[model samples]
Target: MSQTVDRALSILPLLAQGPADLGQVAERLGVHKSTALRLLRTLHEHGLVYRQQDQRYRLGARLFALAQEAVENLDVREIAHPHLVELNQNCGHTVHLAVYEENEVLYIDKVESRYPVRMYSRIGKPVAITVAAVAKLLLADLSEAERRSVADKLDYPMYTPRSTPGAAAFLKELAAVREQGWATDLGGHEESINCVGAPIRGADGRVVAAMSVSAPNVVVTAEELLTLLPLVRRTADTISREYSGSNRPKKV
Candidate 1:
């Protein structure tokens, strides 16, 4: 690496330990005080470092802002949207993408069916945690302690007779989902609706999000819905590959 770029990058890890004075930074970098000061000035101009009231240098607000922006840009919904649409086209049913964040599972993307009969759902709405297939898939990936904690905290609304009744049942269901690597909500969230979901994993093989296919019971029986499981799993796997950059175009 170029010496200037190398020196600038080195400052970040040094500051991460704790704020440091100019002399300390210079000593650690094994550079002249003037050289360290010049480097710090360049970093400050880019908002990568800050000079505090105590005159020590620390990481800057801009660094955090940039980190936030990077996370937002890596949205799984954006990566999964087209796959959801393609799955919807193949199955003729509603397709949804969801993620668990801040103790809530919410729909981030959706592709409505072309059929006259369709399920009523909106993107960005929090899921029925006890009964949504996507919700189950997302929650199933959490550790046992986190699963129990979240299960205890949820309201087990009886939207239907098939809805999960309490934490014990919910935990049991999550265990089944975790074991199977996929999930379903058959007339649980809505008496007329059935859903099947599979986890979309990151490069580390952790479920970062989930996608589901939904069809009204009036349109398809639970057995028929189950028939789509392979397709759903395939689509989820495709999204996981793309999101993890495993499918990136190879250089010539």
Candidate 2:
């Protein structure tokens, strides 16, 4: 990249951290005051930076508008679908992509297994929040207070004997899931179904979605399914990179 363009682009993040005066900007960029002024002026003309009455430079309104527009237009499902398909093909099991919204974790996309014993779930269906791997991964990213509040309000149905039984247990599960950065459902939702999941993060490192791979115990034992954790995590990370515009997604 050209030095001029790189220097101009660097100002946006600096100003985002906080406004800075001309000398501070120039010092940070390791450039002379005149060169820094030129860069800042160019950014100002493009409405990417603002000059305050206090003489500090800050990110401009147009930059914010563009950021919001880009975020609003980003479809996590669209970006993750092909990756999900690739995962299913590799593992020969059901793969799911889910997101938390309005206090619910819902499946936003799924790729079915090639085998006959497929998991019965649909797009937009709210997950078994107390026991699903995808739900655990999504909810684990919530702040402690948010997770506690959500845990307290949810019904702890005995989807299976292994399912999370109450708020305390569910909270404990979420805490572990958060610390470990991954989650699993070992016959918790259904007696024979097992799942492993990983969180898909945004550029800011917050969980924006989760992806999972699942199969019946007959097809893949819980231990065998657990072995897929690394693959699931790799796929999730790839989707995250592509969705967050950090790096191009690679072949799984």
Candidate 3:
């Protein structure tokens, strides 16, 4: 990286905890006051950082503008939101949209269950890398070698009585998921809470993410979930159309 860019980038974390003065930034970065000043000036000029008369520095509006652009560029959540709401209303169950990120499943969006009894999971929560129906969908997207490697390295904790136990079991379940294009958590992650998930394939034929509908086991049977399979897949396909990956080259 260029010296100026690297110097400017190094100060971003400090700005995250609110703002900082020149001396404090210089001290944290282990640079002379003059060097820090020069870097800050350049950053301010480029709108990457901002400075106040109180001598404190924080991230600038340019960064926020860039963040807005990035968010606008991401169409997955936009497309999924309406479908998820519909799914929730129709099934009277909670619905979630989860994407793969750094080996974990990140909940990007979700809808609450309409039923009186239900399990609750939050958006932005990072679930375990090895478990969960949505996580399994991500694993299905990996190449065989990558899948094996990830399975080998994972902790594979037992979240509940029905949770898959080891790498071998996980592999078997993943195979089923690939074959069926869906996965199930039969009260796996949390006993008595069942979930059914289907992979959302991009135009590239890659599994981009998974959408799930979850509810109390007693109220929603696996058979009932299976009955809703076609709707769930349709919803996923509709949203995948708006996903960025849909524009990429597909496998078939």
Candidate 4:
């Protein structure tokens, strides 16, 4: 990319943090005041940045409108199906894509397990939110207060002896999920099933969805399933980039 375009693009994120004066923008970009002014002027004319009477600039309405429009048109399942399929093929296990809706985590897509012993789940089914790996990832994205509220109201059914027993344990699990950027379920929802999952983030870096791979303990031990976590995360990242319309490749 050209230096001019790069510098101009850099100004958007700066303004997004809050309005900034000419000197601040110049310093942040490591460019001279006049060069910064030129970039800001171009952005202002394009309605991506707006100048206030205080001589500071912030993001413009046009940017928000464009963002909302793009989000409304994004069909996450359409963008993610192929990646989920690829993950399923690589792991030879059941793969799932899920989103939080109406206060429930719903499986939006799934690929059947290649083995004869398939998981008893289908697309559009509400996940076992209290203990499912994909559900943990989706719920972990909620605010602390929101997580607390949800944990308080949920029924802690011991789907197995390993299922979340109460709000405190569930909240702790969510906190760990938040810190780790991924989650797992080992005989939590079912005594014989295991799952590993990663979050799919949007351009703003918020979790928009999650994907997981699952198999029966008879097919693969928990330790073996975890070895696929890196692959699961990579697949999720690929889907996130396509869904967010980001062309930049992941750096090592």
Best by TM-score: 3
- Using TM-score, rank the candidates from best to worst: 3, 1, 2, 4
Model 3: lowest-lDDT 10 consecutive positions: 243-252
- Kindly report which residue stretches of model 1 are placed more than 4 angstroms away from their true locations once superposed: 1-74, 246-252
lDDT of 4 at 206: 79
Q: Tens-digit lDDT track for model 4 on 180-205?
A: 99999999999999999999988778
| Candidate 1, 1-252: lDDT as tens digits | 699889978999899899999999999999999999999999999999999999999999899888667545655777888888999889999999888987899887789987899888886678999999999999999999999999999999999999999999999999999999999999998898999999999877789999999999888999999999999999999999888894333442
Candidate 3 per-residue lDDT, tens place, 1-252, comes to 697777778998778778999998899988998999988888889898888788789989898788667645556777678888988888888898888866677887888887788676776668755668889988988889888888888887788867889999998888888888888787778888777788877777788779888877678777887788788888887777766444665445
TM-score (all chains, Cα) for each model: 0.69, 0.68, 0.70, 0.68
Model 2 residue runs over 4 Å out of place are 1-74, 246-252
Against the reference, the lDDT scores of all candidates come to 0.91, 0.90, 0.81, 0.90
**lDDT of predicted model 1:** 0.91
Please state every model's RMSD to the true fold in angstroms.
11.5, 14.7, 4.7, 15.1
What lDDT does candidate 4 reach at residue 158? Answer: 94
Pull out the clashing pairs in model 1.
none
lDDT of 4 at 106: 86
Error of 4 at 78 (Å): 0.6
Q: Please give the distance, in angstroms, between residue 183's alpha carbon in candidate 1 and its true position after superposition.
A: 0.4
